[model samples]
Target: MRADRLVSLVLLLRQRGRLSAATLAHELEVSTRTVLRDIEALSAAGVPVYAERGRHGGFALLPGFRTELTGLNHDEALSLLVAGLGRGEQVFGLGSALASAMRKVVDALPEGSQATASDAARRMLIEPETDLLARRAAVDEVPGDVAAEVRRAVFAGHKLRLHYAAAGRPPAWRTVDPIGLVTVRDRGYLLATRSGEDRTYRLSRVLAAEELPEPAERPDHVDLDRIWRDRSTRFRAGGDQVAVELRLRPSRREELAGTALAVLAEAAEADGVGGAGGADGADGADGAGGWLRMTVTFQDARHAEWALWQLATDAEALAPPSLRTALRDRALALAARYDTPP
Candidate 1:
């Protein structure tokens, strides 16, 4: 581990010259004392490292001294740099490795391309943690040791024992044959099998993990993408999805679709909200024209109610009498709660 840390230290200095000991300590997630010791270690090992003493002084390598790992074209290097700007590396405890690898990638590029690649990466932002609405996405936190053990079992083809806490269930231990690890939108999942039945466990829910000595019972070759797709399809079809017809402003259609499980149908208001509302005393229009009718599916009645509620008066659920009732009840309760000013 120290060796890796030392290599990382050198790479960081090579990538960002004249970084202060405090800066190095922050980057290395260590202490300034440790950084000083590492610098001493590098110097003792014949590395051409030198220090400057002043308010603006820090450690820097000698001119023309850089690690060589060349052989990447401009576009190729740019793509790598841009791809590395995402949070994918945070999954499975690979953040440190990803940082080190990116440093190496920058070092590998020709001098002329190094700045260009970094600039290109800065211009392209991917999967930001928050959206345009300022709503932050939830980040699932997985334990370092658990992720490492799970990754090892998955790669080494060893059986994995996981102390898992599934939704609505107590924590329990399970022995599974790890097939592979998958990361989507910064969330990690372990694809595995228990008693030959497919199982997918969210890494964040793994309280602990252990790699068993026995080899996993998995095929030598696997189409992980296809397997994940099939499992996702089955999961979507298995839930008790509730279908509801909604009359909403066209602008809010995307927002509704995002929360719903599926958009079964979409159509313009043929007669400008005339007869669009069903007979549960439904008043589809709040006097705003250009409403769109959609049949969307949600995981359950409660899910549909909650999603439509978020749109407030902009969207109105037209069908499933129960959903309208739930929304009305929620609106009344909310109004009553706010009836008294703070």
Candidate 2:
């Protein structure tokens, strides 16, 4: 742990020059006294670490000096190699570059450690293509040429004309002032605006793209994180927010949270459930005895219906009469269809 801390201290100082002992302790999650001792230790070890006293005084490394951590011991190299095995770079159109870098790192490893490192990294997986249940995440394929064009336009800060097919809508040409590209859950989206209206387009849905020489009318600097959050909030709020009260099992709380819905309230008790609970409990998530109730918001009635359909036996929708009635009607129709001899 001390070795790791020492390395972390060096890295922190290298990345952010001149940090007070207090700040160093905060960053390293240690005490100021520990930081001072580490500084002395680094100096003794010929690390050229120096300190200053006063209000603005702090610890810093010698000017114009830095260290490379490429001499990675077995586990370190394996970890780095494993990280590069993911297809994350593919979505950003950096697959070849990433592969080349990974190869270089592997080739540069100590001759004796090369085989061991590669074997270990190969045995492990990051973002596996299939889950334990044999479920595979769907990946959208964008034409290489099209993706290249869109990428170029985005970085060049230029307007883009796209032949986009949005959901059930037919393909149409639209000019957008491209802001940035974002990838989430293996899917990529282009954040942009049309006539000053915020618009988000799925990259896969872009059938064709052309870069315009005219500069895009976008802010010179953008807080994409904030913009993405604000856009998401607005999108969720603008739609029909039909809500459903569910009596779920204590175990499925995480699954519920991961969905595109918000839990408004919950009710869990000695049922081995945790935290405060006062949820409506018509029945369990499985329509059985035990239950932890929760009220969840959906985009709309249709959205609620679709999500509940997927949740199936794991969640029970108990609310607003209309929603329950809709589920019942759908269930009856399905049952009636199955009841037929054919």
Compared with the true structure, the alpha-carbon lDDT of candidate 1 equals: 0.81
Off by over 4 Å in 1: 69-86, 272-289
lDDT for residue 118 in candidate 1, whole number 0-100: 86
Write model 2 residue lDDT over 12-77, tens digit each, in one string: 676567999988897766899999899899899889888877989898889866565434443333
Best by TM-score: 1
TM-score of each candidate structure, all chains considered together:
0.85, 0.65
lDDT of 1 by residue, 1-342 (tens): 676677778878777789999999988888999999999998998889999999999999998887653344332343354355456556677656656667767777888998899899789877888999999977779877887798789878999999999999999999999998777777888999999999999999999999999999999999999999989888867778899988877778888888988889998877634433443223443544467878988988878888998998677878888888888888899889999988
Question: Which residue runs of candidate 2 sit more than 4 Å off their true CA positions?
Answer: 1-86, 269-290, 337-342
